[model samples]
Target: MTSKRVLVAYGTEHAATAGIAEQIGVTLHEDGLDAVVLPAVVLPADDVDDVRSYDGVVLGGALYAGHWRRKAKRCAERNADHLKHRPVWLFSSGPVDSSAEQHDIPPVRAVAQQMESLAAREHVTFGGSITSHTPGLIAKALVRHGKGGDFRNPERIQTWAHHISAELAALN
Candidate 1:
């Protein structure tokens, strides 16, 4: 069988969202699927051409003040027609906290309704990285970010990967 092509795109200000997208692509690769994780800012034009090139697309990004990254959202809106017709999934890497088990429902999550409400097969919230842990994101000259390490749950990521894999399999 021909390997399936999946585009996992994310828009992030500091790279936390990009980290999550990369992990998803790794998981999909483990399942022997053709997956490419593209940062929304650097995604190639072919990434949004049509549904024919990819079996599925995963839209992911960070939420700030209750909204997905603007560029990521626009990418979705532009491809709304294809997303509505194909297997689409959305995930947000936000809700900052120190514990992986803590599922803090940030009030800002409501702003992501557009992606969830617009015919996506499913959506999930992820524990985001702490600014304390990600030092390189800000500035390295004057002072180190002073901290590093994401609080996001690896277990939850694996579980979501399993779910997406199953759903994509079902489609094939």
Candidate 2:
């Protein structure tokens, strides 16, 4: 049988969310699925049409001030119709701490709305990263204040990717 094709798309400010998306893609591929990771900003203009080519999609964004990045939001909105017809999962990467690992962080208001509109199967929040290397004065200030670090949990991310793979396998 042909392996399922999964699109792992992410919107990131400093490549943190992209790292998460890449991990997910790698895990999915290891599980024998065909996974492609891409930045949301580079998604085709005819997203609805392009989205149809994938068996499933995992959409993620970097959160800033409790809002999803614009590219992620726009990608979800543009492909809403096709996404609703397929298995969809959404994620957000933010919180430069262990909060996400300690407990579930519900989707932000805008993301919640997108979840409903897209009928996404699930939503997950992963810890983000902020470091001195990250651009922006605010990021540097946060790092200087000892509030910045890479909090993404590889084990948790791999577990979730395996779960997604299991679910997709069941569909076939």
Candidate 3:
């Protein structure tokens, strides 16, 4: 049987969200799914392949000031028709602390609206990172203020990916 094709697309500022998306893609690929990871910015362009071609999609974005990145929002809006017909999951990457790992963080208002629009299966909030390497004056200031560290939990991310794989398996 042909493996299910899954798209893992994300929008990131300092690449933290991209790291999470790549980890999800790797987990899905290991579970026998054909996973393609890409930046949200490219998904909306004319030259890109249609979102309908994929059997499922995992869309994620970096959260800033309680809002998802613009590219991620635009990607969801542009592909709303196709995404609504498929199995879709949404995620947000933010919270520079352990809050996400400590508890279930609900999606922000905009993300929730997108989830409703796409009828997404689930939405997860993952902890973000702000390190010395993260560019931007704000990031530097945060780091200087001792609020910088990588908070993405690999085990949690893999578990979610496995859940997605199981769901897709059931669909087939």
Candidates arranged by lDDT, highest first: 2, 3, 1
Per-residue lDDT of candidate 3, residues 1-172 (tens digit): 6888888888788789989988999888889888854323213222334687789988899999899988788888888989999999999999999999999999999999999999999999999999999999999999999999999999999999999999999996
- Model 3 stretches astray by more than 4 angstroms: 37-49
User: Pairing residues by index, what is the TM-score of model 3?
Assistant: 0.93
lDDT of 2: 0.87
Off by over 4 Å in 2: 37-49
Candidate 1 displacement at residue 135 in angstroms: 7.5
Query: Each candidate: what lDDT?
Result: 0.67, 0.87, 0.87
The RMSD of every model to the true structure, in order and in angstroms, is 4.5, 2.8, 2.7
Judging by lDDT, tell me the better candidate of 1 and 2.
2
Q: Clashing residue pairs in candidate 2, if any? A: none
| Candidate 1 worst ten-residue window by lDDT | 37-46
Candidate 2 has a TM-score of 0.93
lDDT of 2 by residue, 1-172 (tens): 7988888888788899989988998898889888854323223222434688889999999999999988788889888889999999999999999999999999999999999999999999999999889999999999999999999999999999999999999997
Ranking by TM-score: 3, 2, 1
> Taking the tens digit of each residue's C-alpha lDDT, what string does model 1 give over 1-172?
6677788877776788877877787787778677753323224222455555678888776876567777677777777777777788887876665543565353244435655656777777787775543455343431343343466787777778778887888775
